[model samples]
Target: MAQQVNPPRGMRDFLPAQKLKRERALAIIREVYAAHGFDEIETPVIEDYARLHAGLGGDNEKLSFSILKRGLRQEQLENAVVTGTGDVLCDLGLRFDLTVPLARYYASNRADLPATFRAVHIGPVWRAERPQKGRYRQFVQADIDIIGEPGLLAEAELITATSAALARLGLAGCVIRINDRRLLAALLDYCGFNAADSDRVLITIDKLDKIGVQGVIDELRGFGAEFVTPAVKLEHILNSYSEAACAGDIALTESGIAAVLPADLAPEVTSALISLGEMVAPGLPAGVRLAFDPTLVRGMGYYTGTIFEIAHPGSGSSVGGGGRYDGMIGRFLSQSVPAVGFSIGFERIIDLIDLPPAADQRAVALIADKAVDPAVLLRIKAELIASGARVQIATRTKNVRPLLDRFELDGFTEFANVRPEHTSMHDLDFKVFAES
Candidate 1:
């Protein structure tokens, strides 16, 4: 027997039914995004390694894939690699995400584009993270983002638009789960942690979903954070923040506050953070909850303000997430352009909605007498082709039911070929469009 072949574990092959379900989801998402003035754009599947690692900081370096090609071509693939230092070689890694390439696109094409650009894209992205259950080494992220919009309303629009899109997908119990990194920073300062240590603290806490609260505490303590403070003497500082976060006015003495946070940051910054928290709280839509999760630190270092993530209580992981980045673009352009964006994990969303896994099949078989006029046959073929049927000419002696059974087994719903009467082509054409 010939050797059998199968896809790598955590990857999949979608047949007719599954492909249809994915198409349905894509249709709704595109419709919603287009209605909001987002023009569709497609970027390459590979990107330079620098872009992906730029925002990742050090936490996500292990998740990137490097390109082996050297020089300029390798330079192009560098951003796609999860991790690798020095000059490029030959093998280019696949893209880890879309945002890095989009940023590069914006910087390179600034002259040809409008000041404010809104783009929507749906495509595959790869990651080196452990693949299990809903997670995969390769998956799709349907994304929407607006650049050069500086106002908080732009941030609000991303959440609002995403909410509208999800609603169109039939999610009644979904929650937007908005959390501002600025607020987390302020709370962190209040708890007495500097920027470097603060980032470490947040990364540990962000894993709260995967690891329970106690697990987070254990991780934080392992990172060398102080277990006690003057205001609250608890051994675990995270619990103190968890409790003090609800109190409107929790103050610390000079030694109390100075021992925890950096003194270089202005005191007024803390006040402004408190006010922003109040604004985002009442601004959240009904059925959605907003909170100041001191532990809600996103892994991306580029985010500067107002970060948000979407989650369904019944689902095991975040469906999508985004945040404001006011300074990242400044790295490439002479002027800084504020930007914010979100990406919907298409695979995860489709799974959450319980979409069927299958692919659509296209097969057309035509059986007609050999004596039929060539002109007539040509005309018949043209008409079916115009109607978008994949017509296949077959011998008149061949049995159609058996051919149809094979089509059915292969996942083809629409079958067409040479047959007597107009009903033959019309019926098959209708079926193809219906599946489409």
Candidate 2:
């Protein structure tokens, strides 16, 4: 009997093509971040349970995979129940995403970092999730964060850089839905709901795409009679925005919501959004659409200010989203280090489109006849390497086409083979071009 060789469920094993696409995507992302003056940083995959458990991950906290206490009393493992209260057994966990670890990193090294640090992070994060076709337990996220910039400028910068990167990767005119948790707070306040109920309401509202409108009404009823009004009113507000959003009347639509909101809160909300729009609108490239949606409630618990998500109708979910979490790092060091960021879903984008391979230096695969001289083969390989071609010497096999297919799949655009008794090596570009 052979041992099972599959990767763990909800995880993946990337072969040549899969690996190449991800790597090239990462490169394009990093290049964009670099051009904007962000420096790269690395953080450990495993973080203290306290950091991950800090009430910031939203629903992701529920999906974390905890590592059992090392050197544990064997008795503990034996006595532990396998459900619910079972979480007490773990001392550490793989990070759920790059942000929390970045928070910890900044707190640890803030003294030496720049006053306004634009940090780039690219890495894999894990979740103990149920496996699905496109969903995975392990996936890569590319993130950029600007720390210590207290103004709304940070949010504007993050949005601009991310929109540019996605555009560079061919995501033009993607709708970037924007909202502020402050706006959510104000809306709930106007409906006569308390600030404390905001988080619970947001958690339910975030599910609108999955659970439908009636489901949200049912869930809000759990909060008590007063909660029901906010739910009903919110429907009307977002419905109004949707109708007007199609006509490019964002300002007018928001003004309508302003009518029902608190006098002070309404003006603040309307002014901030209008200003943000003006700042981001002028230089933005065509095809990148920005919208002001009253209903955009990002699920993350740490978002304290503006919130955003990338919209792609093809997938029922946003491919990327982020928000201002100026308070997330304060939990680490007990002082505000204002920050904002955006993460493009590396895996989701890979699924949505073809990524051009990383730049190839005109690579050629060399296949030699068995009778060809070992000395001659070495010379051919050396000369090809010198001429800037990544040369691979194909192994002797029953059929050479399979080997050729394998090499071609790895991004070799041409093939070279030495013929026995031939005076010179032959090269073929192996590409088909239609008649012009």
Best by lDDT: 2
Q: Rate the local accuracy (lDDT) of all candidates.
A: 0.64, 0.77
Runs of candidate 2 with Cα error greater than 4 angstroms are 82-88, 242-265, 357-360, 396-402, 422-436
lDDT of 2 by residue, 113-226 (tens): 999999999999999888887688998899999999988788788888988888888765477877788878877877666788888887887777677666777888877987
TM-score of 1: 0.71
TM-scores of all candidate predictions against the true structure: 0.71, 0.89
Query: What is every candidate's alpha-carbon RMSD to the true fold?
Result: 7.9, 3.2
Look at candidate 2 and give me any clashing residue pairs. Answer: 173-287, 173-288
Q: What lDDT score goes with residue 30 in model 1? A: 94
Residue-by-residue lDDT tens digits, candidate 1, 1-436: 9775778765778875578678879988999999978888888898766665565334555576667654556446565464653434434556777777777778998898788888897898877878798888788889998898987667656766777778777655665544467766766666666666777767766776577567766666665536334113222555545444322122223333333334544456344434544544455445454333334566787788867667676567777887887777777788888888987767878866753323442445455555655566667667776866555554565555665555444444554444444433443333342353
Name the top TM-score candidate: 2
Model 2 weakest 10-residue run by lDDT: 427-436
